[model samples]
Target chain A: MLAIETKQLSKSFWKNKVVDNIDLQVEKGEILGFLGRNGAGKSTFINMLTGIIQPSSGSYALLGVQGPNDSIKKKIGVMPDYSSLYGSMTAINHLHYLADVSGKPVSRQHCMEVLKLVGLEEHANKKAGKFSFGMKKKLAIAQAIIHDPQLIFLDEPTSGLDAESVIHIHLLIQQLHQQGKTIFMTSHNLDEVEKICSRIAIMKDGRIKKSGTMDELRAYYQSTITVTIKHSPIRPADLSTMQQWLEQAGTQLDIKENHFTIQVESEQKIAEIIRALGTYKIDIYRVDVEEPSLEEIFLEE
Target chain B: MLAICKREFIQSFKGIKSIIIIAIFLLTAYYSADFSDLLLSLSDDFTSEEKQIIHTVGISFLIMFLGMLFVMGLSHDIVNREMHERTIRFLVTRTSRTSIIVGKFLGIALFWFVCLLTSFVIISIFVHRFDLITLFQSASLAIYYSAFTVLLSVLIPKPSITMFLSIVIGIAFPILNGWVSLTSNVWVSWLKYLFPFYYVEEQNYSFLVVLLLAGVMVGIALLVFRRREC
Candidate 1:
């Protein structure tokens, strides 16, 4: 079954539409990265799916159940970006309370184990209010997965963390991913998303502007293939012949000394250009193909 | 639901506000019994039933004033606190929003019940004999006041503002109710229903009034809260 499915889901505040006609589906066991700029309705969409806010229009299904089913809620976990922990409660106390409410009660020992998983074992007795921002964030993550949910929604799971904490959270996310848990995460950190997410959906103006795998997005947003070529000492005659051959093939070429940078039409053109250069007796040393990064694709109009 | 109740119940005792309120309640019970004893010692013709009624009224007065304040303090932030802290997201994702409201109301009601029982223990120390109906009234009154406070907490975003408004309406409305009696207009007398004092004074019908009021407050709160966005 699909982990999450939404049909033209939308949310509005007065006349302002925050989530507009977003149809999204997340398959089981895949990390689906949700990316959007500020005010792009990323949180609103998560809120609707998690039952925190009702959609003004459209409907959604979670784990095959329709519309915020209690049975489905028990199967899903959420790490909200803006959620705060109880100040006076210890980490274990917070976990126990959340676990019980989620219908998955745990002992203090179990709570400690979960805290330890989040690197909060030593601070188990400290009140949440006294915890540092990064520590509280870790606790929020621990609470989200306390129930061992089938599908987990993590909103900026590693946001506002030190490098070590980020690495720890990344490892935890990888561990969860390896355990066959489907994760839907939203983050502004493009590099992290590129590393952890299997596929991504980019939202703009309350609509999904693009959604695909890394290769698909890169290809969709980019058309030219940039090939940098290094050749052995080429005489001026050979250089002129290579330039003429590249121009005839309709490739954009730049030459400086023995280095030739060619922007070709497609992947097929790279092989064609290399063969043409070889035919010209231009000895080739090395070749490199440059593909666009996810960030560049995301920032494209 | 029980889990939410248990956490809130424990948290109530962890703070000094709850302890201070309960201590003052015990003191009020003591004073009520003492005043009743002084009046009874001076009067010779008063029957046991009449004496019981006098003690009930005196204690009810203390509860009507101070008990409402305690209820206000106990429940004024139940819903808004979660919203303000942005912690409602965690609970709402795991449980139904209706469960959240119901669980919190139950938790606050339980806390108020404990306070009432403690008050009964204190009242028994001096009066030796207390009215069972009065005990029931106090419990119902506690529930009634808590329901309104819960409703106000859901309607208002700010806990401090909710408490301020609750105190004004809870304390001032009754005082204004006295002025309403000077005019014999039917509508003016109808305003007495707005205050808990009217129902607290009812000897035979207070039980029904308190329950019905609690039902209305909770029903409205649930409806409004269910429609509210996180």
Candidate 2:
């Protein structure tokens, strides 16, 4: 079963559409990274799927359950913002409370185990209000996964976090994913998502403009690859010769004295260009090929 | 639902809200036992038997009118405060919105029940009588006001606005209801029925009707809260 499926999902406030016609699908165990610029309706869309707000129109289903209820909610966990925690409640108390609220009363040992996974076991007795920002975030994560849900929606799971907290959360997420839990995450940290997620979706102005694997999105955006060459300084004569040979390739070569950057359509083209350059007898130090990154894909116009 | 109810019930006493309510109820019960003698000597509105009713459980009657105002103070922010703080999102995701409304209402009602039972027990010990009728009356009035405040909080999800209005309704409703009940003019007399004192003032067990009013308010609160954007 798909973890989540939405059809023409939209929400409006005073007729101002925020999440507009967002049709999204997530397969059962793959992490789908949701990326967007600010005000891209990412949070609003997640809110609708989590049942925090009813969609102004359209429909959605989670884990084969249509619409939201205790059953769907019991299976899906939403990582809430740190501000949503009650100040007076301790970390352990929050876990027990949220677990019971979901109609799954976990054992004390289980609650502590989740807390330990989030690196908050020592602070279990501390009030949430007394926690630092990073600690509060971990607490939020602990609460979200207290019931060991099948699907987890982590909205900005590591934003505003310290480096260590970010890594901890990422590892926890990876651990969850390894355990066959499907994760839908939104983050400003593109590198983290690129490193962790198996699939990605980019949203803008309430619409998803792109959705695919890294290679798939890169192919959709641009097939060009960057090849960096550490070669001996090129004479103006060699530069002209290279440009003329590349004219038929429909691209230009960038030469910065000893090093140069070239865009090629395919690995075959790179190999052809390498042989062409070697024929000139120029001493090439090394070559590095770089694929398009998630950042570049997200910034695609 | 029961989990949410239990949390709210325990959390209610974690702050000064429940403490203030309990102290007020207990202090009034302590003073009403003595002050009834002084008031009974000066009052002419009641028969000798009517004076006896006041003497035994005047604290319940007093709370029936004014305790609701205190209840407004206690639960006026229960629903909207969560929305204002963005905590309702955490709740609605875990449980149904109806569970939030009904659970919180049940929690606050439990507090009132405990407070009233303790105070009435004190009154009964002092006067050597347990007024089950007046206890129910006081409880019904509390339920009416608590449910109304929860409904109001859901209607106006802004805490600052509801806090202002709760105090206004708390003070104004009782005074207006009391005045309207005293005035026999047919046109304005119906206005007294709009408040709790009208039912409370009647000897025909009308306070039980306040429970019906509370139930309706809770039903409406559930509907309003279910559609609200968390």
Provide per-model DockQ scores: 0.85, 0.68
Q: How many backbone clashes does candidate 2 have?
A: 0
Q: Write the per-residue lDDT of candidate 1 for residues A202-298, one digit (tens) a residue.
A: 9998999988898888778556567898987776777777678787664567887877787776788888977876777778899998877777777
CA error at residue B195 for candidate 2, angstroms: 2.4
Candidate 1's TM-score: 0.94
Worst 10 residues of 1 chain A by lDDT: A242-251
- Residue A217 CA displacement from its true place in model 1, Å: 2.1
lDDT of 2 at A260: 72
Model 2 spans > 4 angstroms off: A230-241, A256-259, A278-285, B34-52, B184-187
Q: Per-candidate TM vs. native?
A: 0.94, 0.93
Candidate 2 chain B weakest lDDT stretch, 10 residues:
B55-64
Task: Give every prediction's interface RMSD.
Answer: 0.8, 1.5
The lDDT of each candidate is 0.83, 0.83
